[model samples]
Target: MEASKVIHAIYNDDDVLMHAVKKVKAAKHHIEEIYTPFPVHGLDKAMGLAPTRLAICAFMYGCVGLTVAILMMNFIMIEDWPQDIGGKPSFSYLENMPAFVPIMFELTVFFAAHLMVITFYLRSKMWPFKKAENPDPRTTDDHFLMEIPVHGNQQELHDLLAQTGAVEINVVDKAH
Candidate 1:
């Protein structure tokens, strides 16, 4: 496959980067991606990204965890082996639900957290021992990098990025 030309505009401050994103979008330029040292609030809205459905997935996972906890506790305490504790030999799951609240809460949180991490990894196509795709390492520390495809308008893009307070601009040929 052939390599595609892209522009990497580096910014030192996130405020400037946010403004630059707005300007780039206003100029009808398609921003391929942006990298930052930390999570920048509202960056997704600025980039016009669609809302993520991860929250829904988390809720579902929590429900699944709750269900599992209830079933396991019921089977252990009621059906499999009925234990007479605290002078209550009723052997009913509903009566003993209060004692299992903490367990259910912990399992719910555990499932939501672990499943969300796995979902995010799969969604991002990330796995153990994978190669990094970042164009610049400074973005992982103190810099912000904005990537825009170069469609034979390098000069215009460079000028626009310069006006947006980019500290440096480099044309990169990225291989797919």
Candidate 2:
């Protein structure tokens, strides 16, 4: 059971929103979340959020995909089947490599793209087969939302949010 103060603001311009957020931060209030219809360039820095690690994950997943492609192809073509169907040289890694390339490439691309997407989705809390927990339906459209958790001193918090130019304010109690 906890309580949080939330502010909802509608801004057509990202610059205005950035200015408001910077003011709120300068007043030392904790921002729980910010919702927008589109990405705002400087919003992350303004909100004090750490940079995303998705690129590192993508690189690792791509390496894994390459490894999987190589291993599966090598195991099937060399050890398991050892086929000489085209009258090519026997046990030739180089000659048969060209033929297996399409499948290998397909597997590599499939694994890399799919895994990387999944990783990003999961990291961003957008994983498949999971329900979306959108706080408001209107946030998906024209409105921009800024939610702040009131860390201390309720009156001070309210005054600060007011000074930051919040269009609408709400205090929600999660405890039943």
Measured by lDDT, the strongest candidate is 1
How do the residues 27-140 of candidate 2 rate in per-residue lDDT, one tens digit apiece? 777777888888889899999999888777767777787788878878887878887776875495676888877877787678778988887777778855887665667678
TM per candidate comes to: 0.97, 0.78
Distance from true position, residue 145, model 1, in Å? 0.5
**What is the C-alpha local distance difference test score of each model?**
0.95, 0.73
True-vs-predicted CA distance for residue 64, candidate 2, Å: 1.6
lDDT at position 101, candidate 2 = 79
Model 1 lDDT-worst window of ten: 88-97
Assess the local accuracy of residue 145 in candidate 2 as a C-alpha lDDT between 0 and 100: 73
lDDT by residue (1-176, candidate 1, tens digit) is 99999999999999999999999999999999999999999999999999999999999999999998989888888899998888887478888788889999999999999999999999999999999988899999999999999999999999999999999999999988
